[model samples]
Target: MNNFTTFFVSGWHHIVDINAYDHLLFVMTLCAAFKLKEWKQILVIITAFTVGHSITLVISSLGYIPDNPKIIDLLIPFTIMITAISNIRNYGKEGVFSNKNVKYVIALIFGLIHGLAFASNFKVMMFNDNIIKPLFAFNLGIEVGQLFIVAIFTLMLFAYSKILKGEHLKWNIFVSGAGFGIAATIFIGALS
Candidate 1:
């Protein structure tokens, strides 16, 4: 099967391919750290992340930095791992995050790193003056895919927390982070 077929065969696969395990892991880690259920908090964090990533993606595509696909691929997962680490260290037994601003800053940084990762996906595409149209379309596809995953997760959590009464936030962070770190390291090694 083609890569695209493999990607779209399942919602889970699609989410993983377009968004990457590391990006999802980092988002999961953030959700765990903050345990935020309110729409306002989600909106702010999502906006910050989207803005930060879009800026870097556009800049990288516009030739602001030397495009190194393998390097970016490595850094994408590393960024997620680091974000998880930061989340762990930022707040200690104080009940959730210590400061919202700190989370925002870290999210912005990770988002930029993720932008580079996203740009790396476009490295093989032929670039010309008309490249921007297709690039934007690809990015929009990614965003739509990401949003679908987020909405599903949110809905699942809403139901579970309210009806089934199951919450595994902290464990989710730990597991996702550790798994992402290992996966990224292996992927990077393979690329090298």
Candidate 2:
């Protein structure tokens, strides 16, 4: 019970951690083009990501694949950059976000890559040989954290639309651009 609680909290803290904001940036980029009314789509995407993330996390945790922290680290930022570029390219145009299946598939695939990014640290936190309970609790915590992030962005989008009267297209471009820049920098840094 205690270990479960610890793992849950660890997952939550890791996702929401300001020190490592890559995941947060990815979620923000995903929500950049969306508004509050489109929450069902957002939730489905987030859940799809979690499912993919959980699969890789479990596989990596069980020692099925050897960990390559460097490659995974590079891949994580690359995912964010790709998503940001997609958001930037499609914001004003009728584009990929409108296609539900593609959106979820992209999120799920990116989640798999992001799960590998988390694998090394999660491995360090592994308490024992058996990881089922810890993995479940940790993934649940991440899911909740992801929902919280989506909610914040949704409200922010609402506020921008209502209070600021800023167009979502501009917001999407701005936010996605920032995400792209950050991810590019991180990706470059990882390379060196």
Candidate 1's C-alpha runs over 4 A off are 1-19, 91-97, 120-138, 167-192
The number of clashing residue pairs in each candidate reads: 0, 0
TM-score to true structure, per model: 0.67, 0.92
Query: Candidate 1, residue 148: CA error in Å?
Result: 1.4
Top-scoring candidate (TM-score): 2
Per-residue C-alpha lDDT of model 2 across residues 1-192, encoded as one tens digit per residue:
599899898878768888769999988887776666778888998998888888888888888868887898799889988888887766556665667788899999998988887887788889789889989999999989989888888888888888999887788888989999999999999999
lDDT of 2 at 131: 87
| Cand. 2 TM to true fold | 0.92
Task: State the displacement of the C-alpha of residue 155, model 2, in Å, after optimal TM-score superposition.
Answer: 1.9
lDDT of 1 by residue, 1-192 (tens): 443333233323323564466667656555555443455565566556656776776676677867776777777667666666665665444534456766677677767777776565454453455555554555455556556656766776666666777664554455556756765685668476
lDDT of model 1, residue 103 = 67
State in Å the error of residue 5, model 1: 18
